[model samples]
Target chain A: MERGGRFHTKSAELLAQVTWEVAGLPDPEEERKRQAAEFAALAAQYHPHPPLARNLIFAFLVGGSICAIGQLFIALFQSLGMTDVQASARASITLLALGSLLTGLGVYDEIGRVGGAGAAIPITGFANSIVSPAMEYRTEGLVFGFAARLFSIAGPVVTFGILAAMASALIRFLVTG
Target chain B: MVTGNAIAIRQASKRLGHQTMRFETAPAVVASASVVGLREGQGPLGRYFETILEDERYGERCWEQAESRILKEAVNTALGLAGWKEDELDALISGDLLNQISASNFASRNTQMPFLGIFSACATIAEGLLLAATLLEAGVAARVIAAASSHHEAAERQFRYPNEFGAQRPMTAQWTATAAGAIALGLPADGGGGAGWGAAADGSTGEAQLLPRITFATVGKVVEMGQKDPYDMGTAEVPAAWDTLLAHFRETGRDPAYYDLILTGDLARIGSEIFREGMRRRGLDVSSRHMDCGVLLYRPEQDVHAGGSGAGCAASVLASYILKEMRKGRFRRVLFVGTGSLHNPVSIQQGEPIPTIAHAVAIEA
Candidate 1:
């Protein structure tokens, strides 16, 4: 199907509605067809590649560079006598905090703008993912408010990942038995 | 006197038409317009060139308007199908071009749903959809949205040059078309689609529910061609698309025969050929109803620079073009694989490699 610029089709509908409402001219079918045709014709012109790769690199560098700073926290956890798991967990938290800070400072955004996936690649992406939603939830409340409400977007990924991981572990145990 | 007409319009609005959701939503697209052909004899908007191109403001203004329209429609349609209202949505997942992200950010400022800005290049659709599907399956939220947009002008100006750059266009660069798109999803629920997702919104009141869960999504490995040439995107991007498609098929352990249709996002002219050949070489016979959105969208005579790339390029194609075709019972199940070149020009300058990513999502008819 052609969702490419399909919004133009929506414009056709809006135009038709407008014409009908404005003139009451027997549904103004011609205008709808004309607008649709115009959109299609315009769309038919030569297309170009957007600066996607360029943006991704920028996002990657910024997000990744910033994330590198967070990675240092992992070393701190380890040197402070934390276990590997604890280090990793604490690292995740620190990364999340740094991510939120970057987000708040609007720095992560520059990374997003340039690196695209490069920034989105590492743990920073996930950290940004959670913090982004959390920041949005702030408008609603910190407690049982916007934060909980915001879970709908990223909530699925975490839940299913855990479930799937658990399921995999169960399968391994059953096989061993 | 001015107040009279305004009051009249407001009063009429209280009486007719479809119901507008009760949540705040804003426009998402942004652009800058300029005209040259007029001075040199191009298209007709020629005479009105100065009036239009005189300011990039209109172009950018129109962009967000279009983005908002398309984005909102996308979420609304999905919400409608799921029978959910705007107020119930948790947040929006989106990606686009621009550091400021005016299109997506401004768009979000008005939504009842919160926002997350993601930039996976054209992979934004797959990326956002991946997260959305993931969130839905976990029952974390009843409804969520993943959307992206790329303004032809904004992308061109920022990434390359003005429209006239077509003459100096290297084989490496492809053309960005003017388009925008958005999508929405709802999760499995006790009775309806889900808790936050309404079952009685818009046309969704009586529709069959969206699939129970998105189930699984595989983020692609960064595959790259040693060389970087914008002109020959086929060689550059073919491997990435092939890698992801093959991996997804492999992980699922499902034969290509099981799928009703398989599609790739924006693998235009050269890349399309490379993809087909690469698949053949891999010993995978996807000879079924497999096709590329780029090829399907236009007639060959209409030469796109290399092909089309943008969130809307595929989103619009999938939502409007493909959805329209689906009504005809063309296929029962389909796979939509979105490909992206996650490279930055800065990396190329720094002599870094061009890494790419592709994400795949399955749509059942």
Candidate 2:
């Protein structure tokens, strides 16, 4: 059977074919898909596209500043006689704490609103993803609410990270052997 | 189940055509009250709300509890304004944007009145009003209350991310209003007083023509145009609103000029524009007389994106601004089209397209 037709024409035909319809008729699924496509085309005209250039500039500045702050913490820790790796680890921990603190104080979301992906792509964003849900679900109780939901948003990241690491280890072992 | 008395007293058919129902004995909206959180209280319609809550939690322990408390407060305030006690009310119909509509259930539990819980997402207020008006006209009840509510924090947690979660919303996204509204409807007092049970303080009938009455209602069908973007619900809901509006116009033999104003529930910016374009395509121009509660609730500087939404968007606006203006003779006839996107978080996650519904209720003074 012929399956392609404009939505208006198909709909008009469908309306006319409302009787009995035990015989030849256009496929309902095809009609639905056409109608959906038609409506989507119309609706797309009214949907406003986000300003990508402005968001990119904001993200670059804000994300660069966060990294600069991380570098500052690393330098400070190294000045306290810590090794390079130890200083880097300590800086990460400090940033995580800062993210959690700002999230608790209800300020990180404001930064996110202005910074867009800049606030959402850093180590601080990871902390926010975990802490925000924990605080939101605290009213449900500690066991099921706080603990269970603590990683609800960040669980995929951890799970996929471990899986990717294992896969890479297997690939290295196979290649080395 | 049709007894002899049931058949004998059954008035002429109230069903006007396919979708519209004409209430022979129109129910009077006796009283209404709006209670909103600080954000909505600071919006454009702030001055019209009955109570502006300084605290979003309303001194409650949790956000869910706060939602229930606001709903209860709205119901109580409406009852108080109507001068009716709890026992005097016949039934309460209420809903909210929550899992299982727990807000309305908990609020009804506190009221201790016969309750019927309903859910139509944002269109719940109009659904409740239609049911309440039907109960009054059916001779089943004398007085009924219809209410709906939504909380920004509570709905955000359920439908999207946590309130404090850092994420940028798209321009098409609408902010769920933290508000609640309740309205009391009852049979008009005898002698065409136009005042409901408690309105005639001195037993004077001078305000006989002032009361706004629910005269017609059109129940909408679920219309799915396969729109799947959950963040862009304003566009998703336009087709349903258009369907119901067309059905109402066809069934009642009325045009856009029949009513002084046409109010849509929460179609916000894009949806309202699309609706107007669709109507114009059909040779009906409702641009001048049409307004959306979502657009009216907030100012552009409020940064609500598309605008205010949720069950409370329509309910709060209707209970406060629209009815108040109607009472002041600003509009004599109004058509309220409450639009709702019926997709849940689970449905959206399942990759199902969004389906929408709209219910239109006609009110006249």
Top candidate when judged by TM-score against the true structure: 2
> The CA-based lDDT of model 1 is what?
0.55
Question: In terms of TM-score, how similar is model 2 to the real structure?
Answer: 0.91
Q: Which stretches of candidate 2 lie over 4 Å from their true place?
A: A1-25, B1-13, B190-209
Query: In model 1, which runs have C-alpha deviations exceeding 4 angstroms?
Result: A1-177, B1-83, B100-102, B164-166, B170-173, B188-215, B324-328
What's the true lDDT of residue B163 in model 1? 26
Task: Provide the overall lDDT of each model, using Cα atoms, as 2-decimal numbers.
Answer: 0.55, 0.89
Kindly list the per-residue Cα lDDT of model 1 for residues A1-177, writing each as its tens digit.
667478898898888888778886756456545644543343223234557676555655765675677668778899999998898888887776766677666576455544566655556656566665565444345786445745544567789999999999999999995
Q: Lowest summed-lDDT stretch of 10 residues in model 2 chain B?
A: B190-199
**Clashing residue pairs, candidate 2?**
none
Task: Quote the positional error of residue A4 for candidate 2 in Å.
Answer: 30
